[model samples]
Target: MSETKISKLFTELNQLKWSVVSKGVIVGLFAGFVVALYRLGIEFATEKSIEIYEFLKHNQEYIIVWIVVIVVVGLLIAWLIKCSPESKGSGIPQVEGVVLMGMKMRSFFIIPVRFIAGILSAFFGVSLGREGPSIQIGACGGDIIASKLSHNKLEENYLITAGASAGLAAAFNAPLSGIIFALEEIHRSFSPNILLAATTAALTADVVSKTIFGLKPVLSYVDIPALPLSQYGWLLLLGILTGVVGALVNKFVLVSSKVYDVLPAWSRPMVALLLALPFGLFLPQVLGGGQNLVQLSETAQMTVGVLFVVFIAKLFFTTSSFGSGIPGGIFMPILSMGAIVGSIFAQTLSGFGIPASSIAILCICSMAGVMAGSVKAPITSILLMAEMTGSLVHLLPVAAVAFIALLTSDLLGIHPIYEVLLERLVDKDHVNKKHDNIVLEIVVEMGSDVAGKKVSEVNWPTGTLIAGIRRGQKEYVPNGDFIIYHGDYLIVLSSEHELETMNTCLNKLCRKN
Candidate 1:
């Protein structure tokens, strides 16, 4: 073809935008329905758990029967996890393993096991949320579909990311948050290729979810007045408090996991289920994912003292409930804790003439603040709270709180919770597979060792090759003299044997040492 015709052809592929949108829609269709169903399953199971607890509270004679049932369910969950070890704890790290680390996940096994395991865990009143499992399921769904449809592994990874965004979108009915979380937390970069697919998938999933659940905000905080400018100082204080407490919660979860390390993996869930029995009967308010507690605080049903006690109980329960390698998420539990803390803070300062109108606003922002601190995805957290509240009215204050909280967590030397979990997973189950040639996309982060370096200056792995560099809407085949900027997406080629080592080396170079 002539140069003009070739240029036209390249222009048609502008940013490769259309290439991924259809794939994203397909992944979204699969993930949206699946995760929405997963959400429904958890909701139904949790309601049944509440009913069972109410019965146990009244009829002491049947407590033993309920206990037996718990043991059986626990064993079932354990067996389900054994069927696929990838179904364990939150599943976000597993997705990261597949997408970022060039690892593998079996969607056929993971989807079904995670669905059943998540439902069972919720059924018995485990304090875990459905969000993490949902994301994993969605990601697997994307991977399975992409494997059949895409021509390359990189495309499959992009679709996998799209599925993850869809999963979170459907779970919380927050599409923008879903997209942002996939980019910020899961992939840790915002390449245009990723942005294109992730946005499509998240929006599509949100549409399907809304079709099922209706047009209401996940949590009803309508007409809640924003905090006044004079109250901005309180937001800074709230950020510090939640930042410190969220980091502590993250540490507590790791410690709890360590404590459970003494037990065989299968037996760990049994202990967590047994712990649930007491809470099921006595403190049902803090039971399950603690969604009711969030609702209560939103409606002002709980007092400062009551919120404090319940917060303590839920905090301890969540660590054990999640730490035992159960199939659930920290998203809701952490948000609830933040809501409770915000409520307590607002109430404590109520005597000082802070208006009650600001109570719900603070509660909402604090949810974002806590998640931002713990997850290390400040932008995603802010957008998540905004989407969940179904308004942008609180974005300014919420952004303030989330940023401060993230800053606080960083100063304390606490890494993101998912990053830590991914490291532990690597140490425990590092599986190396055999592939003839595999392509992975690694994004150059800002402040990385290689950010300002030229291609010739950086030391690459022996077998690794930089296939191409993607910068925004443009793509270029680099010569050694080309300068690689931060935010560039690199297409790399390697085999299975060297995948792990190359990944480690590249990450070291692409991240701040």
Candidate 2:
């Protein structure tokens, strides 16, 4: 290597490094402001929701009035979905789809729409969480910034991740955990760029949020004794239980959604409304995000029976409300519900001579396990839980449960929640917009025309190209004379308009699915 070449490389590297830092700093500052606004929006929504709940609680004499309020809530969510369908559901999958689907469709209008709709939904006792929506809102902010900046694909990905990190950080007041959430759950990658961007975004958002609201753990903890070493086996057992339970929760949530799809669209909201009505009668605590239950569980204030009832009620309502297509998140609700179940399991096992503190330890571990299994992001699950509860000391137990729960869910063959949801959403969108474009994978079969034909010979559509081909286990950028062969897989990047024109031509030349 000549000194001239070495110096040139160093100069390019320095330029790239500086570019990343500059973009990250700008994204972080913008993301911080967006996160702070998002936090205030959630707080405002929650207070309004509590006010409505209290009003309804005291005005139970007029069943008609309660029905009107419930109907209004349902109608409001329906309007949001109808106006901007992207605002539906947790918004986590939408964010993932935007980043992964190679689709540059940015619904900038969705940010404020979702923020308002989500608050209304939760405030009116819809069983949902805010964290997922917060992630989507944050990502939207990042996406807008990325679009304005002149950057390559990789840099855009980094900026999007930074915004997502800030959103979670502001929502939970957990900066480090937010960074991990973006890395472990969203990007599934670790690098210097990601680390710097995620850390900066999270810290910046935390600073902004703390300036408005004091720095406090999301869940305030009481001084509780740590479990003895002798209870490690119990922790393992709880881990296994949480795994199974988490698997069941995921299964039921999916199944319930499918069931809702089979019902008439008009009846979906009605059914959810009815499902929630019963909670008003006997289990009002289960009607919302269950933040009250979370505080109670942490404080050891819930009785065994109360825990059991709350757990069951929460499980049913969360599944029902989410499955019905009401736009909301399940993040906090799942955590609160898992805590209830864990507490009950621990207290029950305590009768078998295990100490109460040990049972409580099992409860905490179980909560982490169920969260990990359900989300299929064990590292994020464990770290987020630790930060939210201010309990890094329980990392060992939490990690054990998280791993076991993840393994159990995998063995049960349940897909990750967001992936499955994305599949359904995309499928439905495809049917609705039958003319929409799709990324299709095609292979050259032995007897197909393209098997022996060169890329130049095939009547390829405009705006379409053979982006890449995998031939005999080797991948290559396909050029005009790239020899097409049997068993070679071709990735076609095209729009539906182009695809329609090329369909018959390609079918004669190759296999398409």
Candidate 3:
């Protein structure tokens, strides 16, 4: 993993730009169709679940029969997890462990297990979202496709990322947000080639989904006036409130998973299914990833008290569903919760002289805030809000709210939900496992500690070596007296198992303060 070796590796990739990009397009196409069908299936299941609940409400004699059916379905889900353990819970963490931590991904096993179990979970009124399952299906299937078409592992990884981008785009019909999420949340790199592939895949996949579903925002609210500048104070308060709530959600989600660990693996899903039974009888609105609840918020006349109750029920249901190791995500549930919080806040401030039309806009703003606080991806949150709404008029307020919420969560020492989950996944094997050598290219920023220092003067991380430095058109192998200048790309090599340590060390030295 020397500079010359790294250069040679990338040079080979540069020469096959068309090959790589075309592979990306192929993955995108595959991801688009598959994830679209996945979305279609979930939508159908959700509708059927509601109808059945409605029917059961009238047919009291058949309630016991329905309960028996639910138990059987729960057992079936447990067997599905037994068939594919990696398919359990949110698949994002498993995918991350594959690309980042060298964990194995059963490309073939995930698609079927997740698809079937996800549909079953939704049809049974689990408060879990489809976005995570869609991404997993896309990534695993993308990896399968890329493995056959690509000549190298690097190319395969790039195509997988592209496929993941496609999946998110198809799920939400937000192409730009998908690309940004790929870069900001998944890859965590800004290489031009990665950007080129992700953009092409995301846009094309979005086209396919739009063709099937039409070009409408994934979620919609009644037309509302944009917030006036004088109402900035309210945005400030909303940001802090959503931030606190989001951090607490991260904590609860983790705790919920741990609580389920006490049960044997085969019986976990059964517990959650039984828990959801009561809600299906009385609070069906708070089920199935909160889609029903959000629709209720938009069209129903609701009080703050009602919203509070709904929020609590939705939170509990989501945690239980996910904790039982259901193959789903918190993406929609979090947004739904944020919307509830927003509506409650707006109603409480009815006497603040806020315009009647502007009341509905707060829900969207609070969504961005809570997403930033929970996911810790502020740029992704901002773009997702914009693309999902198809309106740029609210960008300023959303950005303000998102950044403030992000800051509040940072101050509270709350980690991002995905990162926390990833740690729990990797920590068990990380203790003694050895990994292959990996090279990382990081930029030197103006405010970085090493910006103006000599290479020998800075203390690098343990088990790491500076492989090379690229400044402008010139490349230099680092020597003790070599100066580290701003905007230089430093190529550092470290063992894969040591990446977390190296990244922590490098960020303090190379990233802007």
Best by TM-score: 1
Q: Tens digits of per-residue lDDT for model 1 on 1-513? A: 344643553454453567789899999999999998999999999999999989988999998987788788889899988888888999999898887777778889998898888888888899999999999999998998888888766678889999999999999899998999998988876677789999999999999999999989777675888779988888889999889878988999999999999899778898999999899889998877877777788667888888888999999999999999889999899999999988898888988867888888989888888888899899988998888787788999999999999999999999999999999988988433435456667788899988989999998888878767778878777789999999887777777788878877887888766
TM-score of 3: 0.91
| Number of the top-ranking candidate, with lDDT as the measure | 1
Question: How many steric overlaps are in each model, in order?
Answer: 0, 3, 0
Residues forming the 10-long window of minimal summed lDDT in candidate 2: 430-439
Ranking by TM-score: 1, 3, 2
Q: After superposition, how far is residue 415 of candidate 2 from its true place, in Å?
A: 1.9
Pairs of residues at least 3 apart in sequence or in different chains that clash in candidate 2 = 49-123, 129-329, 450-509
What lDDT is reached at residue 181 by model 1? 92
Candidate 2, residue 427: Cα displacement in angstroms equals 1.9
Candidate 2 Cα errors over 4 Å, as ranges: 1-17, 47-51, 264-274, 430-513
The model with the greater lDDT, 1 or 2, is 1
Winner on TM-score between 1 and 2 is: 1
Compute each candidate's TM-score over C-alphas.
0.94, 0.79, 0.91
lDDT of each: 0.86, 0.71, 0.80
- lDDT, model 3: 0.80
Query: Can you write out model 2's per-residue Cα lDDT over 212-274, one digit (the tens) per residue?
Result: 677787766566567677777776677777878788788878988999989876567666876
| Cα RMSD (angstroms) for every candidate in the order listed | 2.9, 7.9, 2.8
